[model samples]
Target: MEALGQAITSWVLEGHIVEVPGLGNIRAEVRAKAKSDASDVSADDIFRHHLLLTPTKEIKNALNSTPINITCFDKDGNEVNRD
Candidate 1:
C-alpha cells in the first residue's frame, strides 16, 4: 500500500496522470490567476494546488448500484429514524 501511494505521488508530481486499476485516474492540478501581461505571470500567480480523481466506469456503476442503509438514534438510545 505504501509503495502504491508513493508511486502515485511521484507520477502526479511529474505532471503525469496515474491510473489505479478498478478505481480511477489521479492527477495533480493547479489554479492560477490570469495576468494582464504575460510577463507579469509567475509562480506566485498560482493560488491553489489540488488532486483530481476521475473514477472508472466500473467504480461509478458499482457505487450507483449499491444500496445504502441508514439508521438514526436519539440520545436516549431510542431509534429515531431509518432509511
Candidate 2:
C-alpha cells in the first residue's frame, strides 16, 4: 500500500504517469472528482470524491488479467459456497 501511495504521489507531482516496466504505471488523477450533492432524505449523498483512474490501454487490458482462487469458511471452518 505504501508503494502505491508513493507511486500515486509521484504521479500527482509529475503530472504524468511513469511505467515501472513489470508492475505497470503509477497514475494519479481525481479518481472520483470531488463534488457536492444532497439527497432528499439526507441519508446517503456521495457528491464529493476523487477523479477516476483512466489507465493506459495496456494497463486496462491487464486488469483482472490474473486469476485467483478464493475460499471462505464459516465459524466451524465449514466451506461456504456462493451457490
Candidate 3:
C-alpha cells in the first residue's frame, strides 16, 4: 500500500495523470495566486497545488447505485462508528 501511494504521489508531482483501473484518473493542477493590492507576495509563495480526480463512469454508477459503508478511523486506528 505504501509503495502504491508513493507511486501515485510521484506521478502527480511529475505532472502526470494516473489512471486507476476502475476508479479514475488523478492529476495535479497548479493554481495561480490572485492579484492583491495590499499584499505583495512572490508567485512561488502564493502558488498552490491541487489534486483533481476524474472518476470513471463505472465508479460513478456504482457510487450512485450502491450503498457504500465508509469506515472511519481515528488517529489511534480505532474505528469510529457513524451509525
Best by TM-score: 1
Over the stretch 50-72, how does candidate 1's per-residue lDDT look in tens digits?
Answer: 99999999888999999999999
lDDT for 10 in candidate 2 is 67
Order of models, best TM-score first: 1, 3, 2
Scored by CA lDDT, what does every candidate get?
A: 0.95, 0.60, 0.85
Evaluation by lDDT, superior candidate among 1 and 2: 1
> Which of the two candidates, 1 or 2, achieves a greater TM-score against the reference?
1
- Which residues of candidate 1, in runs, are more than 4 Å off? 65-83
Kindly list the per-residue Cα lDDT of model 2 for residues 1-83, writing each as its tens digit.
Answer: 89977777767676776666555555544333334653343424344434345566776667768566788889999999643
Q: Compared with the true structure, what per-residue lDDT tens digits does model 3 show for residues 1-83? A: 89989999998998899998888999998777666764765667556778999999988888799876778889999998753
Cα lDDT of candidate 1 equals: 0.95
* Candidate 3: stretches off by over 4 Å: 33-47, 66-83
Give the Cα-based TM-score of candidate 2 against the true structure.
Answer: 0.38
lDDT of 3: 0.85
Listed in order, each prediction's TM-score against the native is 0.71, 0.38, 0.58
